[model samples]
Target: MTSETTRKKTTEKIVVVGINHAGTSAIRTLLAQDPELEINAYDRNSNISFLGCGIALAVGGTVKNPEDLFYCDQVQLDALGAKVFMEHDVLAIDTQKKTIRVRDLKTGREFQDSYDKLVYAAGSWPLDIPGVPPEKARLKNIMLCKLYQHAQELIKKADEPEISSVAVIGAGYIGIELAEAYRQKGKNVTLIDYETRVIPRYFDTEFTRLLEDDMRRAGITLALGEKVIDFAPSPQKPDHVGQVITDKGHYPADLVITAVGFRPNTDLLSEAEKTGNGALIVDGAMKTSIPDVWAVGDSVAMYHAALDRHQQVALATNAVKSGIAAASSINGIPGVTVESMAGTNAICVFENNLASTGLSEAAARELGLPVASSYIEDADRPEFMNDYGITRIKLVYHEKTFRLLGAQIGSHGEINHTEVIYFLALAIQKKMALPEIAFTDVYFLPHFNKPFNFILTAILKAIGLDYEAAAGKSLERRPSLEGK
Candidate 1:
């Protein structure tokens, strides 16, 4: 028999908990590459590989079929030689013994299974206030925006004729996206945030100000710098949430969505080494504190490229990348390592597309770094081009070293507008200095770009370097124009 066939005959059982983005990616990678491994994946939820990120698009009617959100199912996993337990909930893990206690949600049967290896990819859950009692907080019209079911429920509630005013708590990505979604549905949308601005964590005040203007123009109300106290029942509809009570004031609402944020789902491994936020601490190889056990996805803290430390970043992109890393490490794959992430992200607000990589000016200041920032406004293409649009870029770097710390880009729906931010993410990871990008060579086409690339212009401006003078010097040194 071949080595592969022989290895498959003496299979090693690998058990994976939670089949979300991370778990699914891990299992698929392991099965596809390592035929010697027998994989069993468990999840309490019936669905597998549901794209929770797409929920906003669905609510906005950008996604036509809700079913398309799920990319994989139990049957598909079974076809790939994985034992899929769709409604199986893992209760506790015995790391020393390499055993897990699981409960079948459908039959209420509980059992223990042993594994040669265990991977934790439980993901995250929406955070609820502690002091507020569940009865007062959990109103019929109040919803969350984390899961596929939550999206369906929100869409159903929005379709109701009685539900007119919608209050979205937290000005993070999901909150802002759902607010716009409700506004597009012709509902009166009011976004409430404890912070002073929208997406305060990822965006600086300047970028947020421009976005806030767009929000106001779109008729979406912003109730910033207010803490949500509780959700109270409406006097008219006692069963539904009628009012959103905040520390500053109260607002009338037929429906409320709490997109405050999420916490890592790492309760099962409470004894494991974790960050303050309860995210398990894993290394570049995706190995957890416990031996023969690994963790990936939102449940674990990932190395932040810019910060040079481990931080919890709960994005699907991180999940998938770390998941594959975990599998490869377990299989003894050579030359595979998970790189530190820069927390690169992008979003579209109304007609504006905003993208960011690494730390923002606000984030750098909060970290107490001596930073310098530059903002530049220029057209995406030549001014004479009919399809030209305005593009604004913000670059942040260290004052002393001029090392790029972060970058943000905003454009008026220009094609491939996020490319500059994507490039900056890599540059920050490489520890590139400002001078490297200030005079970087970039191809130019009048139809798609200006003579001087916007990224180059922004970098030059960041260091007070004159782009015109630098271009003139390059022309003067050209061999063909030496005598002219």
Candidate 2:
């Protein structure tokens, strides 16, 4: 037998609690290495892993079936001799007793399951607007964008002709996507945000301006620098029963979806008292302040090496990485250490795929660092190939050292566009110099890319270096917040 099979045969008890992308990936990876590790997961949802990013696309009718978005099924887990409990709500975590108090939602039976090592990957929940109690959620047409069931219900409700207007109360990622989805369905969509601009924390003002322009072109109404103070059902028009009272003005609507970000899922560790900002405080190894108990995903906050503080990065990548990190630590093994949990996320906005890693320009500037940025706008290939796609790449670097700090790319070329951010992330992790990136070898083809590629072109400009004349066109420009 292989060493991996031998390791699995020798391994002992291990229980992973929660069923999201994080928990699923962790269990799958650990099982691959050591299948003898006892695995048990508890989630109130019917499925183990769900692609939350595709929920809006599914609602927009782009995705034919909802099942296509569900990542891991119960049968997959069952094949591994793992007990998959659907609709199993974990009530409490008794670290002292090493047992998790859980209740089967179907049978209403409670039980305590013991574990030698526990992995808490209980993800996150969307933020409920302040002043709107749980009773407000009782409204027939009002809901928050979360869970697959919510997406299905919204899709069905949004399809009604009577539901003409929708007030989405946030300009974050989910809010932006949901707004576009509603607009695609021929509904008048109004997005409200307290921030001055959408995605203020994620992208620079110029990039955000580009995104806003795309949103406006897609027929989305934005009420930025405004907060919804109260909600009242319309008295004059009962069919149009929703009224959102914002600081700027009142918005009339038929339905509302509050996508104002999320709070970590840390309610189970109340007795631990080390919880802050809805997440348990954890160290670099994903161990909580309380001994033996570990937390991962959105439910736990850790120090970001880049930002250097306990921050919550509620992305799927961070969730899965932290879960794997926690599992390895529990198994007395060394795992990958992610200095920064800020996700390297790739998103499709309009026709362009925009990807980002580490900090945004604004975020980096906020730390009082002297930062220089280079903006290179060029095509991904030669003009003769009939595949001309414009790409905008922004590279952030330290003014003194010229060390690569962060990068963001927006483009249409699928391969080059997707890998640029990931490649930049690797460079940032290794502290690679900017001058060395221009020579990195990449595939070349007439239909695929130009000789130097867009990424290499961007880096050469950022590092104040020169490239060969035989490559594609290049327009190197210093990026500033003035025109944007």
Give me the candidate number with maximum TM-score.
1
lDDT of 2 by residue, 1-484 (tens): 9998887667666666787887887677667666677788778888767787887897778987877888778899878767778899999888888888899999999988887677788888887777664554556566888788887888787689988889899998888888888888999989999998987776776577777877787788889999777777757554344777787998877888888988877877776534457677787678887767778887877765445467777888888788777767776677555555545777675554677877777878988877888776666777686646666788887788777777887754243466767888877766666776666667898787788676777677666564533354335432222222
State each model's CA lDDT, in order.
0.85, 0.75
Q: Output the lDDT of residue 211, model 2.
A: 77
Where does the lowest 10-residue lDDT sum fall in candidate 2?
475-484
lDDT (Cα, tens digit) per residue for candidate 1, span 1-484: 8997887767778999999899999989898887557898899997888887788778778888888999888888889889999889999999888999999999999999999999999999999854555897867878888777887898787678888999999899989999998888889999999889999778886678878888898999899999887788989778778998888898889989888889999999978999999999898889988988999999999888888888999899889998899999988896666768899998897776888989999989999989989876666787677666667788889999999989998865434488677788988888899898666677899988987777877777777775755665442232220111
The CA root-mean-square deviation of candidate 1, after full C-alpha superposition on the true structure, stands at 5.8
- Top candidate (lDDT): 1
